[model samples]
Target chain A: MDKQMLRDTSRRISPYIHNTPIFTSHLLDDMTGAKLFFKCENFQKMGAFKMRGAVNAVLQLTKEERERGVVTHSSGNFAQALSLAAKNLDVPAYIVMPNNAPKVKKDAVVGYGGIITACEPNINAREEAAAKIVAKKGATFVHPSNDLNVILGNATVGMELLNAHPNLDMIVAPVGGGGLIAGTALSSHVFGKNCKVIGGEPLVADDAYRSLESGQIETNYSTNTVADGLRTQLGDINFPIIQQYVDHIIRVEEVEIIQAMKLLWERLKIVIEPSSAVAFAAVLKNKDYFKDKRVGIILSGGNVDLETIRFS
Target chain B: MDKQMLRDTSRRISPYIHNTPIFTSHLLDDMTGAKLFFKCENFQKMGAFKMRGAVNAVLQLTKEERERGVVTHSSGNFAQALSLAAKNLDVPAYIVMPNNAPKVKKDAVVGYGGIITACEPNINAREEAAAKIVAKKGATFVHPSNDLNVILGNATVGMELLNAHPNLDMIVAPVGGGGLIAGTALSSHVFGKNCKVIGGEPLVADDAYRSLESGQIETNYSTNTVADGLRTQLGDINFPIIQQYVDHIIRVEEVEIIQAMKLLWERLKIVIEPSSAVAFAAVLKNKDYFKDKRVGIILSGGNVDLETIRFS
Candidate 1:
């Protein structure tokens, strides 16, 4: 909610998360005509920035709540993050997942000491499964991106980036569930001298872009984007913060996202998921606007299904 | 050749090459039961450690020789490295590649301002083509890894590694044409308090391994290893240095190389070529031998043919 709270959350989760390194590529800088600094969250614990929020949320739990344990429904990085965070803190984590989730995803959660309860592949079913665990086990439910503690935890990303490179003119983050971008915006506003925060969203899943334009939260029915992580819509807890702090949201096509992802792989020599590419894609798409500017880009994650990686 | 020369080379090429960061993974350490430090030369200029040698070699040329320009015969990272290094020094680079070389390789050379001369895909043809360029253009031929200057340049990898983690019990490097390993051995012997230098080679192309035992250079008849970079035989310039200073050579199978490559991609989250994986594979295979020892592994390069990468 404030600078002190974000700093406290950062300190609370410091031991549980990595202050991921920042990488720069001269080739990329030359190609885009912009000075770019990449915050490599792909190297974060559980292979994504989700670990920051997951660890922060778990660490903030009271002794009694921690004993009862935490519950969340995610088949993505958050599941692995929460599982690992709770495991590190000696707290139990109950993860509710859709039955159709990939075996690898299930294995990863189990590998991190999470107890998984499978439900039908639907939002209602997921929420119902999580609620049953909360009710039956007296576990605390933590929303993946809509909780204050989680958002504050994610804010540490921008906090670290700004602390490392304070002269950044703008910071761009992929708008996934509005959590990362909102946190980034808050950090920029509170810590930056004049840094502006921007969001990059999939053109197909342009809920955040539309939400900013309409001054209200919006939903997307068609989530046919290669960036699977950005499919989620904005939440009430983060939307208002985004509206107040976020400068603008840029929507990029699927092709642009894939191209940016490939370039990052080729030039920066780092494995980044399509979601992380969206922010870089946004920067590439609007090179004219970002030209000659010192920009900070959050490489959100690197949790790619290697089997699905086919670069022609 | 010595500590002072290694230090001078580091300082000379400091402006041209990166003092590449060292990365570590608790997962990898736990897997091997050793404290592991990875010197990530994958992030080096031109996507490999070859840049260090190339830049150093070019910088060491006489003023007249530099004016005459430089030349090399290769279709790998060295071609690009020499090209880029020459370009950086404002010298002309004559790169002689096999006509059958990949178009991407050719394009990379041209992209770095090298003038390409294609020849037959054989050692004799490559040598003949390079010799003609030297005779006609008066260019100095810079061997990829067999020249004294290049070996001293490559030594910087070990120099920086020891300077950062001086207490390393052992330093492991992939042995190709022997420049990197020989250089590493010299640095460890001169710079480290008690560091032992080790070489990791492919079992199929185990020339360096055989050379050490036979007390003479040995050629690999079957160079069918997945580690394409390590297929070359040890050269006269580096073989003696390796024999004198390197403690041992560990030959790893192709499957082990691939497994190590995948683990690095999945855990370290960096794109490393199979050649770089060979050193890590060696460590994994001899876990008991290296148990509890502080080991440093040089990740040689990250120049992978993306189309050929299929995990399954």
Candidate 2:
């Protein structure tokens, strides 16, 4: 995507995105000896940063595309984001959520006036369902990761973070389908290469971790992280961007992600799901690099099944 | 406290406070015809608005007081807030919690490097335990509610709400020891009075509601509200302020508070304790006053026992 297009998209969507609070994490700083700034996108509308891309994608659709409606396959935040975004645009959002998806997420999407079609548990079935819907209705398909506008919209978060706290020495974010990391890395790199952009991955599902290392999209592994939001394999478009723009990638364990989630909840009083906590887990594991430095970490989202989380 | 002092304190604490997310409930709006802007203080630093008061109180203390350290008797949010704020300021925090207090609360206090002493569950026992600590350590006693700086700090939330959405026709807040409502009322009144400030009380712990009617601090009653934060009798200092500034006190049943808590979770995707959700319960109960007008509701805190909240 063109840099001018992304910049213009950032301007268009700046007013809509919550310049979510950036809190100085005292407990984290004491724990890691790093002056950390946390950009809490968990507090973003729809309980995730995906709303930025969803709104941008929907709002930019042609009148014919809007008339035809919109469809996407998402297991978590993107479903709710698209639903909420569609509500704002007064357009129909057709979401194909996994039948086994969290009921809370399903309810949130439906609550936002998005009609949902429950598909099979696997990614392939989900895509098949979404593809059939798009074909039947002739509606615009807003791929959660592949879309240009969606990536541009998420890039605004990185832009906003750098704008809010320009003294950042390093930045880290949780990576899933690579949409967040790709957008975040591109935005951060464009802002300045001096600002290190590291991607956080769950050791349980290190698809993106391997993808970046191999310099090609790798979708061989079955996901295992408690971060349901981070389960998807890297999308085709997101892989190249992330491979190019992102610096080092760190994979944290399931327990580490849970520990991070609990720590943020206890210390920062912010409820973040396992996926979002992956970034914090990275900082905790890699204390040497961040010690006594200004670091920015994106708290990606705070949507989790507490009951399931407690068990895990 | 003087009106000007309150404003000064709000200004002092502005940098520390999170301009928390506002969740306008479509369900609650439908239930109550009035549009409600829920000022989510539950998302505050220590999972409650108590942190505002605690930070303000700890920050305002003289260097001599800091040398002596700070102490408080609390089994809830106040304990966590005091511990966190004191730790942030490098001051020792001594907490006297009841033996029956939740493990989570106790863990949170200890996690923040606060010294904890256990006592029997009662107001008399709490004071007695704290008295022993004060006599031994000479720490400055920080009353959870009956303090100036704490109240003023809590007032900043009102200032922020008004700043974010200026045309609020009414502001509803939960009344525990009354620090939050007192500050909220004072700030909203001082900033502008076109908006009425209302307090929500649990029907079981209706002392504040009764005190307002009788123009005096009401006598002891066997209280049994799920709203643990509102179980305390209104403090002497908070009574006068609430009496002068509050428009009306609306009391809600325990079940309604729980119901509101559940609904808010299902819709808002935010974790809030029963006390914080009580104000929304009031709005849901009193739909007539809020129809078509913009109402401001404070989500006081979210430091509830997650197990208790989740199962219930």
Candidate 3:
């Protein structure tokens, strides 16, 4: 991406998004044999990195388009971000999710005063339902990732991280649709000294890693990871951006993800969900690479179904 | 507290503390009829305000005391904070907790690599056991609240709040052993603000409030509130400090505290231990007092006995 474009995005979005703290973890450093800085996007607006893109995309909408409102399909953090951002912008938000999506997510959308439309759990079903809502309501469809404004917004996270701790040797973040990592990589390179940006994916769904290696988007996965937030495939727009900016994609096992979750909760004393813990797992799985160096990990979110999250 | 001493403390302790976010609740503001700045000390070190003191106290200890190690009697956040801080300093930490203290608290302290010395529940038995251990082991005793270092550490939090959000018209923090509010009050004044500091207490164990009103310490409670952390009397150092700095004492009924906990958890999307929730409850209870004015409340800690904290 262009440097000026990214810089302008930072200025426009910084006020709307959260400058979440960068925390040092002595235990984390000792565990991985690396000086670890955790960029707590878990503390980001709407409690995740989704707020960056959501606010950016929402704020950039034309006055006429804004009056028509915005639509998206997300069962997790993005829903909350979009709902809250829409609420902030004094515009209507239409969110479509699976009927079986967690009650908490559904309720959060409704609670934030969003119009919720539920479909079947399948991705095709969600897309179809969201498209119907967009058509019927004349609302702008804000893709979960893929969109330029959304990517620009997510890029602000990297700017904040690199600005706060420029000596970061490398960085890791969970990659779902690749919006967060794309923004992180773009912004990290633009603002801070050149540092490797790593994308973490669960072994249960290692599409991004394979896509990265083969230089082609892979749609298939034999999946069932505790990191529900990272279950989606890399977006077309994000893949090209990741190819340009992200250095490597690491596939972490499910058990390691849970172990990371427990470590962050018990040691950091902060609530983090499995997707965010994927970055933790990536650091632990490849501890030797980070040894004695300054490594940064973005803890993307902390929304979890506590009763069902497998800590093992 | 001398000006330079406060400045020195602020500089010494700035690195460890999170300087956690202060979020304004548009939803809660609409509901409560006041502008609220929720100071998330729940994000603080050791998941509470205890870290501010624990780290400073450990840092301020004499070389002789460091050689001797540190000890404290607590069944809550202070235990974990001291354990974490001592671990950071490479000093031995011995916490004397009641045998019936939550397994989670014990697990957290030990998880942070601190040694625990379990004692009987009653204050007399607990103190006797702790004193005996201190005498036998020659460890430096860090009273949970009745210590100068801790009060000063807590004062820094107050200093931060005033510094970050200068327009804060008032401050309300839950009173446990009065360490947090006492320190905050002193720091707020030392930092040169006329901001009013208020103490929030649960009706079940209102010892600190009673002490302030009666003009003397009246120890007459067995700790019957859900806010397990705020059930103790203010310490000797804290008593005089609170009497001097705190502007008002607000009592939130037990039901109000519980209701507030539920509202905060549901709306804020953060799990706050009950004691921290009381400050929020006070702001809600006295909504009329703060209408159209900016108010601050500390979300004390989230290191909770998760199973025990319940809502109707």
Candidate 4:
């Protein structure tokens, strides 16, 4: 897609999404020796940037398709995002969540007006459940990250970031299902003057980092991470865009992610999930590379389980 | 003291303080049945509204007095605020802390360019330590909340709130040593258009409430409450102002404070100390009184010890 398409997608989803604010801290700037501008997608509708893509994808449906409604399988932020987006547009959303998914997750989906169909606790079970809904109900299936429409919708983040701070030398985001970073990469490539896009991934889930290094999509089997959102691997639709326009991917240890998250909670006073902290952790890890440079970091979401938060 | 003084304080501390943004959560509004506007002083400099008073007090000093520097006795947000404010003004800040004070609190004062003086763990000891500094080093002792300059400094919060949302039917704030609420009352009375000012106090340490009822300064012998920052009693400097302008004071139970704090962390997605939550808790407790009204709540600070934070 081109810059115009990204702009159009932004305008199309403008009514449904929030143009989240950019916050800066002089204390953080002094400590890092870099000018940092944080695009707070954590403050977005449904408390995640996924709303942008979900709203855009839902709005792109045909009149007949809209009537039939949308279907997706996610137990995380996307579940809530799609549910809310569909609710906003008066479209029915069918969510296929694993039976073992936390009750809170299920409640959140239901709270956002989503119809949840429980399946066995696995990716295969989730996909099968979603497929049945699509086949039986004629619901349009929307991939959480591997869809073109979702990427175009997610690109609005880059458009807003660049439009607000055009002099940013680099834009950094966490790699979660490769949607946000890929869309940001495409948007920056089209709209940026000299801005480079980078992705941050947990060392535990270094699929995106390995994918960039091997010049192909990569998969991970490990799910042991505080950044639960980044456990998802790169997809065929997003991998090529990432490989082409993204500068590099930085992998941070689990401790670094938690530490960055705590610092954000302590300093910025905003609640951000571990996934959002990964991008800031990457910036801290690469202090020499980012020193004295103006950098824009996307705080991807704030949908955290507060009871489970640990500072150690 | 007046609108012009409040305006001058706002301008004088403009360089040192943040004109903290006002945040609204539609979900919260829907739940509370009130159009709630949160003046997020939790995001202010030094992580509290204390910065407004601290900076204003420091800037109000004569050039010679500034050269002598400032001193305060506290183990809370004010200690950090005064130190940071003094540092920003190129003045030395002497902080007198109880020897039993947490190492973290001591470290924060030192981190903000304050010279720390350890004393016995009591109010008399803290005052004596600060008095010694004044006698020996010619430092001006800045009260955390009781002094006229600090009250005028805090009045800026009301000025900004009213300036941003002039149509607010009522403004609610927490009463801690009567600085914030008193100043807020003065500001709303001077600058607001028929706006009423209200104070929220903890039932456990309901000195302000009793003082309002008896028309005398009351003391709290037991500080067995979660809102650590609001344990102090109202002083002569601010009590009279509060008595005259503040419409009423609402006292909330400890359970309500914790519940309000959790809701803010969960829904508003911002970290606020228990003292800050008291105001919102009061609002929740008085839902019948506040329903369908345009209310502004000052989130006083975000300086909680995260490890000790327990929802239950």
The DockQ leader among the candidates is: 1
Pairwise lDDT winner, candidates 1 and 3? 1
- DockQ-based ranking: 1, 4, 2, 3
Question: Lowest summed lDDT over 10 consecutive residues: which window, candidate 1 chain B?
Answer: B1-10
lDDT of 3 by residue, A41-127 (tens): 776766788898999999899999899999999888888889989998899999998999878778888987789998999989999
User: Model 2 residue B133 lDDT?
Assistant: 82
Cα lDDT of model 4 overall? 0.92
Report, for all candidates in order, the number of backbone clashes.
Answer: 0, 1, 1, 0
In candidate 1, how many Å is residue A192 off? 2.0
For each candidate in turn, the TM-score is 0.97, 0.84, 0.82, 0.98
Which residue ranges in model 1 land beyond 4 Å of their true spot? none
Q: What tens digits encode model 3's per-residue C-alpha lDDT throughout B190-233?
A: 76357788888998788888888899876747689889888777
Residue B79 lDDT (model 3): 89
Candidate 4 deviant stretches above 4 angstroms? none
RMSD of each: 1.4, 3.9, 4.2, 1.1
- Every prediction's TM-score for the first chain? 0.98, 0.95, 0.96, 0.99
- Candidate 4 local lDDT, B1-76, one digit each (tens): 5667778888999998889999999989998999999999999998999999999899988999999999999999
Using TM-score as the measure, name the better of candidate 2 and candidate 4.
4
Give a tens-digit lDDT track for model 2, residues A183-294. 8888887775488899889887888888877877887466867877888788888888887878889999988888887777655656777888999999999989889988
Ranking by TM-score: 4, 1, 2, 3
Off by over 4 Å in 2: A90-92, A98-107, A115-124, A305-312, B8-31, B40-48, B51-72, B79-120, B128-142, B147-167, B183-195, B212-216, B240-245, B262-271, B304-312
**Which digits, one per residue and each the tens of the lDDT, describe model 1 over residues A49-123?**
999999989998899999999999998988999999999999999999999999999999999999999999988
Backbone clashes in model 1 = 0
Encode model 4's per-residue lDDT on A20-57: one tens digit a residue: 99999988998789999999999999999999999999
